[model samples]
Structures are given as C-alpha cells and as structure tokens.
Target: MASSSTIQVKITAARKKTSLLRSLPLPLTLSFPPSPPPTVRDVKTAIQKAHPSFYTVRQKLSLPDTSKALPDDSAVLFDSAGDAELSVGDLGPQVQWRTVFLVEYAGPLLIHPLVYHLPKLFYGAEIEHSSLQKSVYAMVLLHFIKRELETLFVHRFSHSTMPLFNLFKNSAHYHLLSGVLLAYDVYRPAFSAPAVAGTWRANGTLLTAAWVVWVFAQLSNLSAHLTLRALRPAGTTTRAVPTGYGFSPPFALSTPNYFFELLAWAAVCALSGSPAAGLFFGVSAVQITLWAQKKHAAYKREFGDKYPRGRKVLVPGVF
Candidate 1:
C-alpha cells in the first residue's frame, strides 16, 4: 500500500495538472451584429437630406464622422466600407438588399412593356405608307432595344439608381421619344399642315443624311450604354460612385461617342432639309455635347493624376 503522504502528493500533482488544462485559452468566435433591410423611402430621404455636394462633387469627396457611417436607406445611395474603392451600390446591408430586390427588378419590367406597345399603337394609327411605317418601326425598335438593355443588363446588378444614371436614362428615353415624334411629324402631319409641306418631306438628301446620322448615333449610344452596363454592375468592386459618365477610351475626348452622335444629327438635318428637324437636332446635340464636356472636366479633376491630360472635349479642336 502507498504511504498517506505519498497518496496526498500524488493527488496534489493530479489536481495541478487538471487546473493547468482548465486554464488553457479557448478559441474566439466572431459575432456579427444583425443588419436590417432598408426601405426605399429611407434611402430616398437620406439622399434628399444628405448634403447636395455629395451629389455634385463625387470623386474624392469626404463625409463628416465617416467612422459612424450609417446604412443607406435610399434607392439612390449605397453605403460601402473601405476607402480604396467604393461603388454606388456598395451601401451597407439594408440598403444593398433593398436595392437588389425592389428598385432594380421592378422598374425595368414596368418600363419595358409600355415602351414596346406604345410605339406599335402609335405607328399604326398615324403612319399610312409602308416606307413611313418602316422608318417609324425602326425608331420603335431602338426604343425597345434601350428598354431591354435596362431590364436585361442594367437591372441585373444595379439596385440603387444614381442621379447621373437617372439623367442618362431620362435623356435616352426622351431622345427616342423625340425621334419617334419627329418621324410621325414628318410623315403624317407634314402633308396636311400647310406650313410643314415641302419642309417636312422625308425624301430630301438632308433627311437621308439625318436618318443615317440617327442610325450611327444609335449604334454609338448603344455601345456606350452596354459598356457601362458591363462595368458598373451591382455588388462589383466599388471604385468611385458612377457619375453615369462612364469610362471613355484614351485618346478620345470625354465622350467622343456622344460627339459622333451630335454629328450624326447635324448630318440628318443637312440631308432632310427640314427646318424643324434641324432646329431640334441641332439644339439637342449642342446640349448633349456641353453636358458631356462638363462631366468630363469634373472627372478629370476628381481622378487627378490618373486622368488622361491629352483627351479633348467632345469635338477635337472646336470644343
């Protein structure tokens, strides 16, 4: 048998060993706080209330108390973390989820059906001749193309709608509508309306040039929108907030593509010999080029050293 003192010594050693084992540190587990979904109204209100400058001077702009950054509640703004890169759709959990589910999915679907049917109905009612109908149909086709792009491509990733994005979308929608109207105005009404008689005929070389210009402009516009749709998808790497200006290739002005579109319109006016078309296209073209230039200068300022210096404004030297 073991001695009592030996037994006690053995028990003490066992207890010490148990204590050491118990004192060993356990692995830590991370617990993330629950994030709630933001409502559409919440996001909208945030944008309206937020500093106007936030909308204006986007690149390299700062927010006060950024450390206490709040969730984006609006359909326009996304709140993402990190400074190196952030995108319009990067807002915190609530805002991000809301954007994907509500704004992006619903808006395009509602717009698409209306866009397609309206042109068809209007064309049948007003355009009588096959040639006139075909031209109007082409305009209608372009409308559907733009709408489909919004639904199939842009809505795929974008949850929140940036102001610049909204502007571009609105402009496109209006431009297409204007084109359709002009076609109808030329074909159906020109004959009946005394003042519009010779001036509105679609056969003039100026009109032909206008049509050609429109076709090329459509191509360029589609290319630009598609390229932007690919790069600025939602949940992608966020860099600067999308001004909807998009990235232009080097050796080109801010939006050389838009400038091409302007020229296309000018050509159309020259070919058509329609004073109305000339006035309308000329004014719109000037406005669009000016807008592109303004946005380009703003971008150059924001990007600083990264911005290309040699790129001209919309037109090479004339601008």
Candidate 2:
C-alpha cells in the first residue's frame, strides 16, 4: 500500500540500522598496532613480541583503575568495546614487572644461626666452657638443622613463589632472634656463674627434663608436618582436615602443629634459663596463636559443616 519511494526509504533505514549494529565497537579497547582490533591472545602475543621479558603465565593484564583481571586471554577485544579506552603503558606510571623465584625455606633456617655462632667463636664468648651454654647451642642448632632437613624432604609449600622482599624480612627476624638467644646464653656472666649456671646445666635435673621435653616436642612437630604433607599427594592441590597424634587431642585442636611448636619453644626457654629466651618464646607464642586462630577461622569458613565443630585454634583444650 506504500509508495515506491517510501518503500525504498524504509528499506534503506533498516539496512542502516543493521549496519550500525554491526559496526558497534567492543566494550574494551586496547591501543595496539593492528588494522582491526585483535583477540586477547593476540594482544598478549604482541606484547610479548615487544617485550620478551614478560611471560604469559606470570603477567596478568588488568584495567587501569580496577582490580578486575582479564579472565580469558582468548576473548576478542571487540567484546569489551563499550569499556574505557586502554592505551599502551597504561597499567600505571610506576609499573615495573618483576620475575618471581622459589627459594627453599630451609636455607634461611640453617644460615641464620651462623650469624651469631660464627661471631661468638671468633670473638671469644667462652661458650664452650659452660656445659649449659654448650647444651643450649647444641639444642638450638639441632632444632634448626632438623627443620632445614624437614623443609627439604617432608614439607610441601602451598605457594610456589614469594616476593623477594619477604626473604630478607624472614631472614632478619631469625638472624636477630638467634643473635639474641646466643649472645645472652654465651656471653652473659649470670649464665656462666657456677651458683646460677649449675642449676640449669646438662647434668642438672631441670635442664635435663627441659631438654627431654624439647626433643619430644620437636619430634612431634615433625610428625605433624609429615602428616599434613601426606594429606595431599604429589602433583595435587587438596586440603584435608588433620587428625591429632600423641599428646594432641583427636579432632579437638585445629592447629596441633602450632601447639607443639609453642611447647618446643617453651622447653627451649626453660633450657636456656634466661629472661630473654622467655620473652622470645612469649612473643612467638602470641604470634603463632594469632596465626592459628586465623587459620582455624579460614578452615571453618571454607569447609563449613564438614569442619570439625569442637576444634580449638591452637591449644588442645584451653584456647
């Protein structure tokens, strides 16, 4: 019923609408060199070509002001047409990419004690003259050496890489603490005096009991680590609820390992018979307890009803 000219106009209008819809750009725009917009993979490839240092797995492409990372590298850039225009080097002004590497945790544990011990040997601390000092040094060295061996063979790290700065921080903490313990035990006149030192010597009942407890606690802690490692087989990522062992209450403590660690340090404090050792153990206890509580809450949230209901955070029955 319409005129021929009107019909032609309607047809042209429909064609123009279709063309407009077809020509609409994607939600995201990447400023890169290409005739048309490329796929995310193509963009990554282009970036890699430009900078060979950026690896695909390690590098994550993110928006300028948002924490949202691109989920799919295969996604076409046209799909993100309506988003803000992205430009090359727009990640941030101070964006410096860093390569990540894994260093075994054992290395620092073994190395930190030398910071104090080597100096003591050279500077004449008279550590070897006192049996208590010798015993304390032996215990401390044995503790960390065992830890290093366990880290190398028994433990599995949840994360493959940590920031390089963390290495220095961790090393500093251990090095300083080791220095404090060794210095006080070896150099202090109070510990070397026969009246005070004889009570905590290797042959003394108190020191012997403390040493026994330390040995037991260390062995138990190692057992806990091995048990945790066994929960997940090699080449798999799975978390399982830990069962208790030895003095640990069955299914009643969420972090029996932390408990054993605290006990071990407490024994070390008793063995050293120094206020500094006690202070270090107290501080360590608080830190480890806080960490255990956090881990407990995380486990409860993650596993929900499946998580054991009666589990304490760090202590077996008290905490």
lDDT of 2 by residue, 146-200 (tens): 7667766776765444444556665555555554454544445455546354353
User: What is the lDDT for 39 in model 1?
Assistant: 31
Model 2 TM-score (2 dp): 0.66
Best by TM-score: 2
* Off by more than 4 A, model 1: 1-137, 140-144, 147-151, 154-159, 162-184, 189-212, 236-251
**Positional deviation of residue 31's Cα in model 1 after best superposition, in angstroms:** 13
lDDT to native, each model:
0.43, 0.56
Q: Return the TM-score for each candidate structure.
A: 0.46, 0.66
What value of lDDT does candidate 2 attain over all alpha carbons? 0.56
Give a tens-digit lDDT track for model 1, residues 236-269.
6333423233233432566655776666556544
Best by lDDT: 2
